[model samples]
Target: MLIDAIRIYCQKNGIQLSTRDKTLAADFFEHPHDYISDDYFNYKLHSFICRSHAELPEIFIVEEKGNDFLVYERIISDFCCLSQHKQQAPQSFIGKKIIILREQPKTLEAEALYATIKKRISGANLFFLPLVAFSLLLPFYSNLFNSRLVYSSSLTSVLYITIFFIFFALLEAFLKTSVYKTVVRATHDNSIKISKLLMYILTITSDDSAPSTTRAIELSSVSYWKAISSLMVDVALLLVFLICIVLLLGEYSIILFLYYLGFAIFCVYARFQSYESSLKSIAINNDRLIDSISLHNNRQQVRFTNFDTLRHAFYVKSLASEKLSHQLDLHNNRWAEILKLNTFISMVLMYIACYLAINTGSLSIATIIAVMIINSRLSAAMIASVNGCYSVKVNLHQIKASLTKLTQHIVLANANQLHLDKIEQLTLENITIEPHGHATLAGYNANFTRGNVVGVVGKVGVGKSTLLRAIIAQAALPHGAIRYNQVNIHNIDALTFQRQIAYYQPALQFFKGTLRFNFNLYGIHDTGRILAIIKYCCPAMTVDINILDDVDADALNFSAGERQKIIISMLLEKQPSLIILDEPTSFMSDDEGLDFLRHLIAQHHDAIFIIASHNADVNRIATTLINISNTGKHKKIFINTPRPTVPITVKPQGGLAE
Candidate 1:
C-alpha cells in the first residue's frame, strides 16, 4: 500500500527521475508512506532548492513487486544561457502516456470546417423581440389611423391630414432610431451606445473589433439564414393581426375603407425601414465577432478593413438591392398570380352576394367594392410580411450563436490567465514548440531578463519569431510555462503582457495620416524620443521625411530599412518592458545596421532586448547565445557566450582580415 501510494503521487504530479536528478527524486522519496505530496509537498520541496537553482521538478515513481522504484525525475528551469526552450517536452511521450493527441486540420479541410460551423450556429434558436413587438402593433395602428381621400372638403382637408401624418411619420422615425440604439446597447456592452444607430451603417464597420473578410463570409452566411427565420416569425404574427383588423374594420363605409387601405400601406413602409435598421445592427455585430477572434489570436494581420469591402463580400449590396429586389418582384409577380386567384374567389362570392341582395332588394355595388379592397390588401400583405419575417428570424439566430461562441472563447482565455501574473522576467521550463511537421524547438528552456539585452541566434527555421509570439501570448505558444517573475503568465491578462513585451517585425504598414499619426498609434506622445530613435535607425531619413504630412499613396516606395526604423521608433515610444526586434536590421547597410543596434542598446537599456538574428555583429553584442536544432525524436540545444571582438572590416583585396 505504501509503495502504491508513492507511485500514484508521482504519476499525478508529473514527477520524473533522471540519472542527474536522482538526488532530487530521493529527497521526495524521503517522505514517509502516509505523507501527502499535495501543494504542501510541492512548496516544501521547492523551498529546499537554492534560488539560483530553484526549479519546478517533476519526479516519477513506478511501482514494482511490493516496492516503489524511481522511474525518472527531472528538475527543469529556464535556459536563458542556452536555447529557446529549456523545458522537457512531455508531448514527446504521448504514445506511452495519453491515449490521444489533437491533430491540426489541413488547409484543404477549412471549407468543410466552415460548413460545420455554419450548421451549428444556424441550428441555434434566435429571439426577435423588437420585430415581434413591431409586427403586432403595426396592424392595430393601420386600422385606427387609416388614410382616406375626402370627397367633401375639396382637396384642402386631404392636404391637411397628409401634412399631419408626415409630421407623425418623422416623429416615428426619430423615436424608432432612438429605441434601436438603446436595444443595441443593451444587447452589447458600453462600447456601442444608443446614438450609434443614427449612422449605424457607417460607424459600426469602422470599429477596431470588427471582423475581417475571411471570417465575415462564414459569419454572414450563418447570419443570412438566421435573418430569414426571424423575418418569417415576425411576418406571421403581423399577418394574423392584420387579418383581425381588416375583419373588424370592414363594416365601416367606403371612405373609411379607403382610409384603412392607405394606413396599411404606410405601415408596410415603416416595416421596411425597421428591417433596414436591423440589418445595420447585424453587419456591425458580425464584424465585432471577427475582430474578437483576431484580438484573441493576437494576429497583427487585419482582415476586412472597411464596410464597403464587407458589404461587397457579404453580397449585401446585391442581395438586399438585387436578389431581394428580384425576390420581391417575383413575389409581386406571384402577387399578380395570387391576386388573380383571390379576385376570382371574391368575384364568385360577390356574384352570390349580389344575387341574394337583388332577391332581398337591398344590396349595392359600392359595398361590394369596399369589401373586396380590404380582402385583397389583407391577403397580399400577410404573405409578404411572413416571408420577410422568416428571413430576419434565421439571421438573428445565427448572429446570436456566433457572438455566443466568441464570448465563450474570451471567457476561456480569461480563465486561463486567472492564475498567471506579470513581472520583469519570464522563464520557460521543459517546453516544446511545434512550428511545423518536421521542425520544432523541443525540450528547450530560456530566460528573459528585464531591461537587459538577450539575443536568440540559430540556423533557419529554428522557431525564433514563434518564441517571441509565445511569450507575449499564452494562447499564442504551442506549449510552455511562461513565467513572469516566477508566476506563470497564464494567470495574467495576455493583452497587458503583450503591451508590456512589444514586438517589432519588419512588415510594411502605413496609416492614412501624417508621420506623427503613425508614431502616436499607442496614444504615445513623446515626440522627442520618436525623433531620436528615427535619427539613429535611419540617419539619412532615406525616403524624405519632408513628406511626412503628404498623403502616402504607396507604402512600398519606402525602403524596407526605413519602414523598420519607423516601426521600431514607434515601439520605443510605447516603452515596453521587453522589446523583441525580429531581424529589424535585415535590410539596412552594415554601417546603418550597426548604428541602429548601438542606438537600441543605449536608448532602451531599461528594456529586456531579445533579438532573433544571425548577424555576426548581433551575435557579438548578445549577452547570451542559444542555438536550436532538432534531431530524431527530440530537440537539442546549446548555450554559449558572446566572444569579445573588434569591428571586422572589408579589405580592398577581399582577403580574410580582422
Candidate 2:
C-alpha cells in the first residue's frame, strides 16, 4: 500500500517510472564493477527518474554521455525526510531539496608498489651502455693477433673466425638467456601486485601529458652506463694478460694457448656481471617511476563530478597510453625484422676482420684458426644482443598495454573512495534502494526515530545491508530524499555522514589483535561507557582492567563471535546516534546470539536501532518490523508494524515496565 501510494504520488506529479527506470535503479543498487560489466551503467538516467515525487524535481539534473546518461542530484534544502516534505504542484517541485550519495574510487597500495618497481627498471634503458661500449671496442684486443686460434691464411682466416665466433657466441647467448629467465623467476615467484605493473606500464606508454615514462626511459639508459664502464675494466685487463702471454711465448706456442683460455674466462665473467647489474638497475628504476606517476595521478582532477562521468573520464584518460603501446609494438616488430639483416652484417664483419689479420703476417695457421673462431663468436654475440634488446622492447610494450586495461578495470573497483564523516543524525524520504545481494530491507520507508528500536526481517539478499550503505550514501539509490536535520544531507560530505552510524555485521572482519586491543584500539586509558557496553553486550563477561597492561592480549585466542561482540561493544561505547546490527545472531550459537541481542536492546534504548535478521525471537521485541523479499518479478518492501512496544510488569524493587 505504501509503494502504491508512492507510485500514485509520483504519477500525479508527472513522475515517470518506466521499466527502463526500474532497470536503472537496479544498476545503482548492484555493485559498481558488476554494473559496469553488465552494461547497467547505461541506465543512469532511467534510475534518476524513479526517485522523483512532486516535492523535489529541480534539485536534480541529468546529462548525456555517449549512449548513456548521468544524473546529478543536488540537495537544496535541509528537509530531506519524505514524511516531512510538503507537497506542491509537480512544476513547483523543480528546485526542491534533495540529498545525494556519490561514489569515489581509490588506488590500491599493492599496485602502487609494483608500478614503483617497474618504473625504476625500464624508465632509462641503462642496459644498453655495456652493449654499445663492448661492441665498439672488441676488435682492438690482441687475443685476435699473431695466433692460429681463429684464422690461418686470408681464406682460412675467414673460415676459422666464423667457426670460433660461432662457439663463443653460442656460449654467451646461452648464459644471457639463462640469466634473464632466472631474474624473471625470482621477481615473480610469489604473489605479484597487479596494479603496480599496470601503473609503470601505463606511464611509459601514456601520452605527453604523462611525462614520467619518458623520464624513466632516460634514467634507465644512464644507469646502464655504469655497468658498461665496469665491463670495460675487465676487457682492458684481458688485453694486458693476452699481450703478456704472447710476449712470453713468442718462441713457444703453449703461451698462446694459455692466453686464449684466460681470455675466454674473462669475457664470460665480464658479460655475466654486466648483464646482472643492468637488470638490477632496471628493476629499481621501475619502482621509482611508478611512485612518481602515482604522486602525479593523485594531483590530477577529473573534469566531471558525477559518478558516471567520472567513470567515463577514466576510460578517456587511459586511451592515450593504450594507443601509444600499440604503436610502439608495431615499431618494435619492424626493428626485430631489421635486426635479422644486422645479424648477417655482423657475421660478414667478423670474416673480414679475421682475413685482414691473417694477411698481416701476425697470425700463423694456429693463431689464424683461433682468431677466426673468436671472430665468429663475436658476430653471434652481436646478433644475440640485438635479439635481447628487441625482446626487452616487446616485453615493455606488452606490460604497458596490459597495465592500462587492467588499471582501467580493477583499480576503480577496489580503491578507497569512502568518506569518513561523523554523522549525528540521518533522515530518509520515500527513498528506496533496491535489494542486491543480502540486503536486509528492500522497499520499506521509515525513519529511525532517535532512541527507538527498528527490526528488519527478510529472505536472504533482500537488501537489508543495502539500506545501511544507502543511509551512509556509499551505494547508489533512488525513490527518496534523505536528510540529516534541516540540512539536505546530500550536500554534506559523505565521509562525515558515514562516521555517524556505527555498525556491526555478522561478517565483521577481525584483524590480528587481542580482545582488549581490538576493543580499545591502543587508546590511552579506558572509559566508563566501554565498561558498561561490555557488561551489557557480553553475558557472564566483565571488562578486564589488566588487559591494557597485558603483553599477549592480541593473539588468536577468541572465537569469531566473541571477537564480533568486542567490536560491537566498542561501537556501542562510542554511543553513535544510529546503530545497525546485521545478523548479530547468525554468527553465534542460538542462545548466545539471542542473549546478545536482548542485552543490546536493553542497553542501547536511547540510540536509534535497526536490527537486520530473520529470527522470530528478535522480531518479537522490535518496535518496527520491515519485511524485505522479492516475489519473483521485483523486490517488494513493506512495514509490517510501527510503534510497537511490549508491556512489562514491575515488582517492588526490581521490575520490568509493563
Candidate 3:
C-alpha cells in the first residue's frame, strides 16, 4: 500500500520512474520490515528516491499496515525531521496521494509526559548519591591517615587508598556523564511531544477560551527549560536530605542530626511562604503593568479629555507596579538575611558540638574535622534545596493551570466520513446560537440553497453575527445541528468544509505584507484576476498591476472604503460556494455599497450569499431576510421566492479531507 501511494505521488508530480534506483527500491520492498525498523535505512532509501529534487517535500506518505514508515516526495527539511511532522498540513496534501502518519507511539498525555520526565530526572539524580557519599567520607578518610587513628601510616596503605579514591572518582564521573546525556536526550524528545500536544489543544480551542498568544508560547516552549531545571534541583535536594540521614546514623549524634534536620525543614517552610507572597506580588505587578501599556498603546482611540484621564490612570498603575516590585525585592532580601543568620547559627552549633565531643574524648580528631566539613556542606545543600523545591512548585502549578484551562471547555467530537466538493442546501435544524456562553438566538430553523441571497438583520448586539458564526461552526450550537447536503457540519472535515466558504467581517485585518502576498494568502495566485477585481471594485484607486506594493502598513495607504473594496475583491477572487459577509459595506457609501452588492449577486448567481447588515438596500437585494429580535428569536421576512431545498449529490471520498 505504501509503495502504491508513493508511486502515485511520483507519477502525479511528473517524476520519471527511470530516475529512481531500481536496486534500492527492490531492497526496500523485499525487506520492508528491516527498513521500517531502521530509520537510517529508511532515510537512505527515501533519500535515493528524491535525490534528484531540491526543495524539501511538504507532504509525506506512511504505510498503515505495519510499522508506519514515511516516504517523502522531496528531501525532508530540518524542522520537519525534528518535529517528525506531528501535525499534518491537510490543505497542502489535498489532491495528492499523501498518507498522514501517526506520531510516535510512545507519545504520552501532557501530564503523563511531565511525570515521566520528572521520573527520569530523578533517576539521573541518583548518580549524584555516590558522589555525595564520597565527598562526605573523603574528609574522614583523609584525616584518618593524618591522625593515624584508624590505620598506621604506611606508604602501601596510603597508595592503595589514593588509587581507590582516584579510580572511584573517575568511574563516578563517567557514569554521571553517561546518565546525564541519556536524560537530556529523553527530555528533548519529550519536549517535542509536549509542544505538539499544546499545539493541538490550541488548534481545537475557540479563540475566546484560548490563552493569549504570548502565554501560549510561554507554555509550549519557555516552560520546558524551567520545568527541567526545577526538577533537577528538586531531585538533587532530595538526595541531599537522604545523605543527611545517612550521616546521622553513622555519627550517632542525635542532637547534631536533629539540629541540621530542623534547619533544613525551617528553610523549606520559610522559602515556601516567601515564594507564595512573591508570586502574588508579581501577578499584581504584571496586571498593573499590562493595564498601563494597553492604555498607552490605544491612546489614539481616546478623546483629548478622555486621553488625559487615561494617562493619569496609566501613571497610577505604573507607579503601583513599581512600588509593589520594590517591596517584593525588599521582602526577598529580608528572607535572604534570615537564611544567612540561620546558617551562621548552624555553623556555631556544629563547632560547639565538635568541641564538646573532643573534650569528652567521644570522637577522634579526624571524626571531629569530618563532622565540621559535612555540617558546612549540609547547610549549603539545604539552602539550595529549599529554593529548588519552591521553583518546582511554581512551575508545576503553572503547567497544571495551563492544561486545565485548555481542557476544561474542549468539546470532543468523533471524526466522520463526510466530504464536500461544493456545499449546497445548508440546513439549520433548530440551532441555538450562543457566543461566550450566552444564548443569543434560539430554535432558529433555516435552509439555504444555491442562487439564494440571505440577509440577516438585527438590532445592535441582537445576535446577527452570532448566527453567522454558528453557521460557520465558529460559535457553539447547543440545541441543533447544521447540515450541508444532509450531513452535519460538525461531521465534515473542517479544512474541507472551509475550502468552499469565504467568510468576511469588517474587523478582519491583513498581515503585514505586500499586496501580492495578501492576495495569495488563500492560495489564489491569479494576478490578472486579482487586478481585474481590484479595478472593478475601486476604479478611482489605481493599483500596481504587479502587486508588489505593501498595503498592510498604515492600512495599505488606502481609505476605509478603498480598503473594504480591496478586501471584498480578495474574497471574490476565491470563487467560493458560500459567501458570508457581516456588515461588509459598513465603511462604504450607500450607493457604492448597493452597487457592489448588485455586482456580487450577479457575478455569483449560482452561489449562496449570506449577508448580515442593517442597510435597507441590502434587505431589498436579499431573497430571504432573517430578522432577529432582541429577545433572541428569529422572524423570517421573505423578500422574494426562496430557492428549492434540493441537495446536490457529491461523491464521498475516503480517509481525511482537505
Candidate 4:
C-alpha cells in the first residue's frame, strides 16, 4: 500500500525513476518492517530511495493515517563520504510532506458550482436598492416648476435638490465600480476551478456529441444575476412611481396607469415573438462571417487560387449578409418605437386631464404640472421594467439549457476503488468504433501484451486513428469492451490509466509558451534524458539548455519534420508503459522514418508499442500486424520471432536536419 502511494505521487508530480531503483523500491516495500529498528513500527517507514538523489540518497517516508498515507521526502547530503559506523547509527531527519494518498474529493455538479459563485456575488445585488431609491426623486422635480414660491426660495430649493441628486448619483457610480471589481476578482480566482469542470465534462462526454468550446466558455462564465437584479430594480422603481402618481392625482392617475399597463403587455408580447428569430438569424450570419475570416487567414490556399480576390469577395459577402440580418431584426422588433409612442400619447392625455382638473377647481396649476411630471416618469420606468423582464427571461432559459447539457452525460468515478499499479495486458473484445456518421470498424478483437510492437496498416480514411483512440478510451466503443488486465477500462481510474500511456498524432499542438514548458508538460524533467533524446532524434537542431526561448510567434519556422521529431523525443522521455503512434513519420523521408522505427524497436523494449502507418518498413519491424480493409474487417498477422529484450543504439542518417 505504501509503495502504491509513492508510485502514484511520482506519476502525478512527473518524477521519473531508473529501472534499478524501481526494482529496489519494490523489494524494500515488501519487507519494510525488516529494516526498521523500532519495536512499535509506528505505522511509519523511512529511508526508501527515489529518483531525486545524486551521490546522496533521497529518502521517502510514508506514514499510515487511518485509511490514507502521508508521503514525505528527505535528501541526505554527502552520505557516501560518511563513515560506515555513522551510517549504521540511527539517524533523525526532517522531511517535507509532499502529498497525501486518499480518495479524490468528489467533483461538485455543474449547477452546484454555479450556485456557489452566484452566492458569492449576490452581495452586489444590494447596490441596486439604493439606485432604485435615488430614481424615486425624479418625480419630486415637478415642485421646482411651481409658481407659488418666491424666486429666492425656489432657487434655493433647486440648488438643494441638485446637490442631493449629484451626491446620490456619485454614490451609485461608486457602488457600481465596486461591484465590477468584485466580480472580476471572483472570476479570476475561480478560473482554474471552472477550467477543471470543463475538462471533466469533456472527458466523460462522447466524442461525436461534445459541446462547442464557445458554448462551454459562455456557460462557465454566465452571470444571470445581472439580468435578475436589473429586473427586480426596475420593477420596484416602477411600482413606487405608480403609487406616488396615484396618491397625487387620484382617478386620473388610475386610468392612465391602466392604459400604460395594457400597452406594456402588448409590447412584451411583440418582443417575445421577435426575440428568438432575431437571435437565430444573427447567429447564422456570425458563423458565416467567422468562416470567411478563417479562410482569408489561410493565405496559401487563396494565393494559389485567385490571388486574394476570392478571399476579399467572400469576406465582403459575409459582412453584407450580417448587416442585412441585423437590419431585418431591428425592423421586425418595433417595441422601442411603440414605447415612445405610448409616452407621447400619455403626455397628451395628461394635458387634457390637467385642463379639466383646473377648470373644475379640483387641482392647482402647480399640482397639475407635478402630476404630469410623475406620469411621464412612470411611463419611462414602465418601459425599462418591461425590457428588464424580457432580458431576465432570455438569460434564464439559456442558462437552464447549458446546465442541462453539461450534466446530461456525466460519468462519475467510484472513489473507493484503488487504481492498478501497472497495465500488463490490454484486450479488445469484439469492439465497434463509431466515431461519427457510420460505424467505421466493428467486431474487432485483439490482445496486446507487454514488449510487443503491433503495427496497424490501412489506407486513408480506414479508421486507423479511430482504432487508436478506442484503445485509449478517448473514442466511445458502443458494442464491445476494452479491458486493462482483465478489468474494464471504465472501471479503472482514468487519470491513473492515462499516466501509463503516451499518445502521439500528426496534429498534436504546442502551446504559446517556452520550449521547456511544452517539453515538460507531462512532468518528466530529467535534463540529461531530454538533451540526449533531442541530440539523437534531431541532430542538426540546436537549442538552449534552459529552453527559455519562446515557440509562439515563430513556431512555423520549425519544419513539420522537426516538430514531429521534437514531440516524439519528449514522449519517449516519459518512458510510459504504452506508446500509441499514429502516422508518426508522415513528414519524414523514407530513410529517416526507417531509422526512427529501428530506434524505437531497439530502445524501450519493455513498453507495448502500437504504431499505425502505411509505410511498408513499419510493418516489417513489427512482431504482429493488423491490416484493416475498406469493409471494416481486420486481418491479424503474427511474425514468429522472439521479441527483442535488449536495447540497441541506432542513428538517423537523413531527414530532420535544419
Worst 10 residues of 1 by lDDT: 98-107
Per residue, candidate 3 scores C-alpha lDDT tens digits across 307-328 of 6777787787677667767876
Q: Candidate 1, residues 1-658: lDDT per residue as tens digits?
A: 3344444444444332222223333444443222331111111111121111111123332222454222333322111111123343432222222111111112112233334333432222233333344433433333323433523345787677567656666666666566556544433321121112112222213234423432443445544544444454545554554554344433332333354355446545544444544455555545545645655554443353565564465464335445444544564565457446645654455455445554565544344444344445554555456446545454544444444443233222332243222247767776776655434566678787766677777667767777766766623654557777777665665444535666766664666576656655544334455566567655665544454446652333556777777777766654567777888788887777777887778877777788886576887777776555654254344559786587677789997568
Q: Candidate 2, TM-score vs. the true structure? A: 0.41
**Native-referenced Cα lDDT, model 1:** 0.49
Candidate 2 lDDT over residue span 1-658, tens digit each: 2233333333333333444334433454344233232111111221222222322233332222343222232232222323224432333333433322232323423344334434433212233233333332234233454444334557776667667766666665665456445444433321132223334435323243234443443333333322333333344433443343344324332434443355445434433433433444444444445645664655445343465765565555455445544555565565456545545653454345445544665454444434434444443443344334433443444344433433442322322223323334556666564554322333445565666677777666767777666664455675676665434544554333333566777766644454445554422123454455555545565556554345454353445666677777666655466787877777677767777877777876766787887577787778877676665344455668765387567788896666
Identify the candidate with maximal TM-score: 4
Error of 1 at 203 (Å): 19
Looking at model 2, report the run of 10 residues with the lowest lDDT sum.
Answer: 37-46
Give Cα distance to truth, residue 21, candidate 2, Å: 58
Order of quality (TM-score):
4, 3, 1, 2
lDDT of 4 by residue, 434-510 (tens): 44434556787889889989999877776789888878877666689888888887777744454567788998867
TM-score-better candidate, 2 vs 3: 3
Report the CA-based lDDT of candidate 2 relative to the real structure: 0.47
Q: Quickly count the clashes in candidate 4.
A: 0
Cα lDDT for residue 621, candidate 2:
74
